[model samples]
Target chain A: MRSSYDVIIVGAGPGGSITAKTCAQAGLEVLLIEKRQEIGDPVRCAEGVGKEGLIHHIEPDSRWIAAELKGSMIFAPDGTEIKMSEEASSQKAGFNLERKIFDRVLAQQAAMAGADVMVKTRATGLLRSNGSISGIKVMYMGEVTEIKASIVIGADGVESKVGRWGGIDTSLKPVDINTCTQFLVSNIDAGEYNKFYIGEKYAPGGYLWLFPKGEHTANLGLGILGSKCGTVRPISLLHKFMETYMPQGKIIEMVVGGVPVSGPIKQTVANGLILVGDAARQSDPLTGGGIINAMDAGKIAGEVCIKAKEKGDYSVKILKEYEDRWRATIGKELSKSLMIKNLLIKVSDEQLNQLAHSLSGIDTSKMALPKVLPILFKKNPKILWELRTLFI
Target chain B: MSVIVNRYKCGYCGACVGVCPAGALELVETWIEVDNTCTSCGVCAKICPVGALVVIK
Candidate 1:
């Protein structure tokens, strides 16, 4: 690796790879680093992405897709199911992907775009120049190497410290943190629509989910609020779902991870430093969906960073454009999702049961949240009044 | 006391390491290391995504 570059992105996930690809394609020297020996091994995500947000950026690749989905089923604690209408769910078509393969392909694209790529290179800390980031200190091939850059993109995952190291307060409230565990089980019944289960019994302060990867395979997972999940382990909750829902399922693989269901932080850019993906908490606060948003931020940041490089200014003033562009892009929806997540977790299971009952009688698959939420809680005026921010 | 890691279950995503108040848990890309500073507060165990870290209180 060269001693320095124009951009060095930590973590070769979709966000990092895309940033590297976009900037390198613009003729900037870029380097992408992955801590794992393989680019996308030990996949920790549910691997679901919407086609509307994804297809425009990445072409349809059969090698990375496991299943295409039309809609989803929302189940309440009482086993009542609300099948989203095909049209509504079709508005945002979904896909269950092989993230391990998908991530590697994105990284390879970055390399093809002229970015240097390295696996098993761990970023240990930031290199500070006058209280701002000048480069990164990474353990590459078991040797500490200081690589300098005009810009650094922290595409690290949810537990990323690069934001913290860059003077951004990345602290999360317990309610904002979700402890997630999943099992990829095979030889079970899989369906076209994804399924979601909500209740304290399933996942306190969160929900349980099943996204089908194939005809007889699915990724079953649950996330619970860190504060609400006192003494309750996510694995036990996942196993309970296995026993109660799919007793015949055979375990194929296991993944454990955290999702920052919180909204984006106060700021994502500092002097010569920008945060992307989970590092920036760009994931949807309600569904923990992030791949598209992360890539969105990466694409925007690449453009803004290139502008800054061309002008020979890497200060916070120049970098703030990334934050502005991202906010104008997907930031509003993410903030709304945070509000929705907070309200859902605060409500009781009985209310959720009532919601399921109400929805079961109507066709809500095509309706958006503003149109659907009021009906879901029509009986509870107090709750609706409290959530007026979303509707009104 | 420090937290114990279950090799069979840990995904090594480092959620426990990030939440450690004592700064005792470290994820070195391959293995998790617990230092002598651990007070066994069990925050790491509670915050562990996979239930791999355990505090034997």
Candidate 2:
């Protein structure tokens, strides 16, 4: 790789690769780095991305699509199922993805756009000159090397060290992080729609999800509040959940990771550096899904970086524009979703059953997840009184 | 760098120390701790099995 580049992005996941691709396409030299030996190995996510989110970045590739989902079934603790239509589940589109293939395709797009792709390269430290970031020091196959850049994008996930190294406070609270574990199970009977089970018995402070990948394979997972379930491993809980709900299925793959249930970080940009994707806490507070938001941020940041390079100014003041644009577009929805997450955590199993029963008969033809708030208030006027505090 | 393990949330799984590349993390008396000369990479905070370790900003 050259001694320096116009931009260097840490982490070659969907966010970093997309950012690199966009910047390179704009004629800025870009360098993309990944710590893993492979671009998308040891998958950390549930491998499910909504159809609407994927379309915003690029056209859907057939090779990346695992299955097309129609809708979602919400199950109460009492087993009362509320099936929302596909149109209702996604205000736009939906799908289960083959994440490994999808992530690799994104990196390949970046490479094709003229960005230097470096794998097995771990960013060990940030290069600072007089309190300003100039580049990053990386260990490539056990050899330490430094690559300078005009701008650095921290696309690293939930445990992002790049942000911290750049002086951005990206810490998550215990109650705000979801301990997630999943299994890719085969031979499971599931529908075209995804399934979500809610209850303390199944997953406390979170829910269990089943996103069917094919006729016999599905991504089965659950995320629970880390503070509530002590001494119970998330993997063990997932196994118990499968035993209770999908006993006959065979496990094809097991994965564990954390999902930031909090909204975006207070600050996402600093002098010569920007944070994207999970590093910026861009995942949905309710769903713990971030592929779309990450891609959106990547596109915006890429555009901003190009502008900054033209002006020869990589100051925080210039980078702040990206933050303003992203927040103006998706920040409101993320904040609203976080409010819903906090409220959902306070709800008891009995209350969930009651709410599920009350909404079981409602017309979900044009419903959104937030639309259920009004119905929740109608069933229990007390919730309306309590939720008033949230609205204000 | 201080690894603050919320006593209430930590499950003591030792996954944080396991994933640490700098060898700066260790379990002390059932609680995870970070030693001096730490890099503050946030790997422990990221890999903490229970979301217990919050790297103090």
lDDT of each: 0.83, 0.79
Among the numbered candidates, top DockQ falls to: 1
- Residue B40, candidate 2: Cα error in Å is 14
lDDT of candidate 2 over A1-392, digit per residue (tens): 89999899998989999999999999999999987777776666777776766777889877988888776778999998876654653543478888889899999999999999998787877998756798999888679999999899999877677887888776665676777777889987867878899878788788889998878899898888755555565767788888877789999887666777778668999898999888888988888888888899999999999999989999887899999999997677788778778888888899888888788668754554656666667677664455654444
Let me know the DockQ for model 1: 0.48
DockQ scores of the candidates: 0.48, 0.10
Q: Least lDDT summed over 10 consecutive residues: which range in candidate 1 chain A?
A: A84-93
**Would you give me the overall lDDT of model 2?**
0.79
Indicate which candidate wins on lDDT.
Answer: 1
What is the number of backbone collisions in each predicted candidate, taken in the order shown? 1, 0
Q: Looking at model 2 chain A, which ten-residue stretch has the lowest summed lDDT?
A: A84-93
